[model samples]
Target: MPITLHDAFVPTAQQILRAVRGLVDKAERHCAENGVADSELIEARLADDMWPLPWHVRSCWVHSGYAINRFKTGVFTPDFTDIPDDWDAMRDQIDDALTQLDAITPDTLEELAPQTVGFELGGQRLMEMTGQNFLLSFTQPNLFFSCLHIL
Candidate 1:
């Protein structure tokens, strides 16, 4: 059978989102067991210049579920707002992403596959590609990167 755009994107995104959700749960448990405050874990970063745990968790949503929704608009832009600052909020963000992913029908993504999607950041056009390419090449990698940081 031929691989549809939906085949390539939605299931993978859903799986990654679920993994992120699990990681958030485990992190909460670890913090509680270790007597580490949620704030400390949320604010932790792998490096001095990198974003904290909450940002990485939020980015998973932004690059997966949020990116899929934005494809309908023919442009892709990274959202940096409303990043969760606590453990519960991080889990909530993941849950919201899962909910959004669940609402996406295969037909919607299939229809968008061949459509043009411009990627813009900081008011500059980074690149323009088909929706399929944007999702597979750009957003999926970004989702994985964010998830890796949380792990």
Candidate 2:
């Protein structure tokens, strides 16, 4: 069978988000077992120039469920504000993303596939493409990148 836009995006995004949730649980367990504070892991980063753990987690949500919602608006803008700095909040973010994904039916994505979505940053339009392309080419990659960093 030919793949639909929903088949290509929603399930894949949800799987990645679920994996992220599992990793978060493991990190919390590891921290607890090692006598390390949860905040230490929350604030930790692989490099000085990169955002901390919370940002990666937040990005997963932003690039997946949040990005889907933005497709309806015909513009995609990266939101970097209000990243959660605590464990509970981080989990909540993931949970919220999962919930959002669950609400998106296949017909929703099919209807959006041909619509134009602009990629904007800092009041500038960086690119424009069909919603399908925006999701598969851009949002999906960013979602994976964020999930990888979280690992």
TM-score, per-candidate, Cα-based: 0.95, 0.97
- Residue pairs with backbone atoms closer than 3 Å in model 1 (clashes): none
In candidate 2, residue 130 scores what lDDT?
A: 96
lDDT of 2 by residue, 6-41 (tens): 999999999999999999999999999999999888
Off by over 4 Å in 1: none
Query: What lDDT would candidate 2 get against the real structure?
Result: 0.92
Could you give me the TM-score of model 1 versus the true structure?
Answer: 0.95
Q: Which segments of model 2 are wrong by more than 4 Å?
A: none
- Give residue 143's lDDT in candidate 2 (0 to 100): 95
Clashes of each: 0, 0
Q: lDDT of all the models against the reference?
A: 0.89, 0.92
